[model samples]
Target: MSRILAIDYGTKRTGIAVTDELQIIASGLTTVNTKDLLQFLKDYIKNESVELFLVGEPKQMDNSASESEVHILPFITTLEKVFPKIPIQRVDERFTSKMAFQTMIDSGLKKNQRKNKALIDEISATLILQSYLYSK
Candidate 1:
């Protein structure tokens, strides 16, 4: 089976995660600058067989779209245009950041290490991918 890539899109940076070839065992791939996201995906896809794009959909507690949705929507449009064959799915990402932080603490990361925004983003992407896998 092809891999399912997960993206946690942020304004300044984007986090990426992917499942194994068997579509199991979600793992953090990397975090990239938002401006370089498409290029990163392009290069990654050249080396990997990706079947789907699982993007995080930020929403408020009341189920309304978050302010960041504006940014992600345009990116998604561009993504669709770039990779027409791959399907995209959005997973509700209400508290992934907080969960990532908790995971960092649980893992006993140092205070300085815990401040790594890129690491948090990567973890959040892994969580997003795992969420989709669990739902399936």
Candidate 2:
């Protein structure tokens, strides 16, 4: 099977993750500037056989869509347009940031390393992808 790519969209930077070729294990890929995200995907897809785009869907405690959804919707539209063949799926992303931070601490990251927001984003994307994989 082709790889499945996960995206944790942010206004400043976007986190990326991908499954192995067997679609079994998900791993953190990289973080890219939001402005350069499309180009990054374009370049990535040229070399990788991505079958789907798994995107994080942010929600609030009330279960309503989060305000950040506004920013994400446009990016989703762009994804549909640019990668017309690859389908996109959304997974609930509530508390992923907190979870990522906790994972960093659990993994023995130092205070300085834990301060890296980009790393948090990448881990969040990995969590999203892993969640999807297990759900299947």
Candidate 3:
């Protein structure tokens, strides 16, 4: 079976994560500039077997769609246009960035390393994927 892919989309960067072919064990894949994401995915799908695309859905405390929609909707539209075959889903991303930062600190990441927003983004994507896996 093909693996599942997840994305944490940000204005500046986008994080990617993937599950194994057996659909177990989500892992952080990479973070790329938002502008480069489509091309990056095109290159990535060429080399990997991905069946599902999970995108982080940011929301406010009251469960309303946050201001992130301006960017996210466009990205989702682009994904649908570019990868029509893959099914896309959204997972709640509340507190993911905070969780990612806390996880890095708990894991003893150095201050310099923790400053890597790309790394944080990737971890957030991983967290989103893991959350979905756990829910299932």
lDDT to native, each model: 0.97, 0.97, 0.95
After superposition, the stretches of candidate 3 with alpha carbons farther than 4 Å from their true spots are: none
Q: RMSD of each candidate?
A: 0.4, 0.5, 0.7
Where is the poorest 10-residue window by lDDT in model 2?
Answer: 91-100
Q: RMSD of candidate 1 to the true fold?
A: 0.4
lDDT of 1 by residue, 26-120 (tens): 99999999999999999999999999999999999999999999999999999999999999999999899999999999999999999999999
For residue 31, give model 1's deviation from the true position in Å.
0.3
At residue 121, what lDDT does model 3 achieve? Answer: 99
lDDT of 3 by residue, 1-136 (tens): 9989999999999999999999889999999999999999999999998899999999999999999888899889989999999999999999999999999999999999999999999999999999999999
| lDDT of predicted model 3 | 0.95
lDDT of 1 at 31: 100
Per-residue error for 32 in candidate 3, Å, reads 0.5
Q: Which ten residues in a row have the lowest lDDT in candidate 3?
A: 69-78
